[model samples]
Target: DLQQQALDSLVQHLADHHNAEALGVLCDVADAAAVERAMALTVERFGGIDVLVNNAGITHRSSFADTELAVFQRIMAVNYFGALHCTKAALPSLIARSGQIIVLSSLSGFAPLLYRSAYNSSKHALHGLFETLRYELKGSGVNVMLVCPGFTATDLRKNALVGDGSVAAQPPLAMGKVASPQDVAEAIYHGALKRRRLLVLSNVDWRARVLARFFPRLFERVLLPRLSGLKPQRAGRF
Candidate 1:
């Protein structure tokens, strides 16, 4: 809630002062049909999509045992399938233009957090998909970058799904620990500009990721406690 208001205010200020003709906001869901329509509209308007930012996502805060099937699927639908749909729709234009694809993932993608099964799985799957796609699309002049942001304030928490495929009782606020929306946007721009394979936005996220790899048991022992405490109350109930 704090971050949303700030972000909205910033957008308004920029939109007013900059008179940014290149910037246009649209309401397009990440579903297959919506992406298809968006792509068609974009191509019709701008001639083609030079860059694709696959950032649409939702979150969940519950253990796998407590998470419902529908909740899990909904998370996948928005976080993973949404990206897929948009990427598929935009690929033809990107391929033609030799453009770039930027994916906004999360730290949870690299290292799992307790009580975040749906959210973690969606991001992990996204990482796998994009990493493989990058290799497969080599020499095609298409660049893919995955941007992993660590806990910048976002409304997804307020709207995050719970076990019953409904909004969580509380926002995902407590789970996130660092950064800001502007910080994340800057990271996104920098990574896209440099065409980096993976751009980690958080100050210590990369280090944490590496540490987790080198010391799994130790990482879990430390992280699980912190994560468990952040779990949403009454979240797992179907």
Candidate 2:
């Protein structure tokens, strides 16, 4: 749980819905010590961590020039360093068990979007770090999966930061199908079970990945106007 209320909500949700025992621990993944404590609690509750899911993330939705430096820093702290700290804390158990590591990346991990410089950067960092880790753990039996979900219907949208670091009051422009959070979760679950290296959910996400890979210049030209909620200027007759 990243926040106190998040822990309470998880506990209550588990109590109300699931019969299996669930453990909750408060952690600020940005803090190495906090992650250690949370992982320790997890180990104390269970025998060992078989799977490490680095899913906690935050987003900033302001243009690079307008967005505050602090906003970018905060996003990196939660989205990149957060996962780094958690993975570091859980590595020993994961190595011993040949456990799986599931990283919650985004379509932006490969596809760039305007007004999301910080968000995209964090995810790109995850890909670089985990892809290297995957090679290192190839024969060690620990499989890594990076799940890239397209725009999902979730609270992260409500928490997106604007230029001044304030939450954006309006909802984001709909550039693609907004997948249900449940759908994304189920896809991630199955992908982890199958030991997939990179799972891009939804057709929209796949298109984004493909465009970025094979038609990057075209993708960038189209994405800028779309994300900015504007139409690109047409070439005027000279």
Candidate 3:
């Protein structure tokens, strides 16, 4: 629903600007056939795809101790496999057009917090996949970008699954406050236009990455202690 709304708003804006050349919005679940069909439709209509954004993702609030095997797989299916399916489907057209592929990662990918085993692992996997892909496709005229956002105000947490596979009412965030989704979107757009290698969505996230890099021991000893506490646990567990 959020992705559709975003795409609708984008297409409406394009139509308002009288850009008839802009491709109409196409949305599909991150399934193999769906992704393939969507990619085919985009190529058939637009003649080529210039930018492919793998933004379909989901979050779950569950620790490994109580997290069900199915729940973990569900999160991976949506967040990790979903992006992989879309990228693979879009690759042919992207390569043909010498276009760009942008993967929306998260601060968790850089620094894992508590109770986000699935989400953190998914983004970490994405970071690894795309970073390597970037190197492989370096001279092929295809650009790969990773955009990591700290915390954005969205209904993602509300949709997060708890340990027992129940919905988590409140989504814990890295920062107490979240930046607007529009702000992150704007940054993503700018980075794509400029062909930037990586785009960090917020200052806090940037600091976390820097701290993880320059002061690994201090970050693990100091920062991890606080962030790790945010993981959701049953009341009786502690």
Best by TM-score: 2
lDDT score, candidate 3, position 19: 71
Query: Candidate 1, clashing residue pairs?
Result: 157-172
Best by lDDT: 2
Q: Per-residue alpha-carbon lDDT of model 3 for 1-238, expressed as tens digits?
A: 2367777787788888877555554554456787788778888897888898888777877778888888878778778888888888888889888999999888888886667887788889989889999998988899999998767777776577888778887765545457788888988898999998899877767767886778766666656555665333222211
State candidate 1's TM-score.
Answer: 0.84
lDDT of 1 by residue, 1-238 (tens): 1245655666677778986434233444445786687688889888999999988888877778888998888788888998998899999999999999999888777887777888889999999999999998999899999988877776767787777777877775554366678778987888888889888876557755875688666556655445556423332312
- Report the alpha-carbon TM-score of model 2 versus the true structure: 0.92
Q: Which pairs clash (backbone N, Cα, C closer than 3 Å) in model 2? A: none
Candidate 2, residues 117-229: lDDT per residue as tens digits?
99999999999999999999888889999998877888887788898888889867666678898898898889988999999886767866876798766556665466556
- Estimate the TM-score of every prediction: 0.84, 0.92, 0.84
Query: Candidate 1 regions off by >4 Å?
Result: 1-15, 22-30, 173-177, 227-238
At residue 62, candidate 1 shows an lDDT of 72
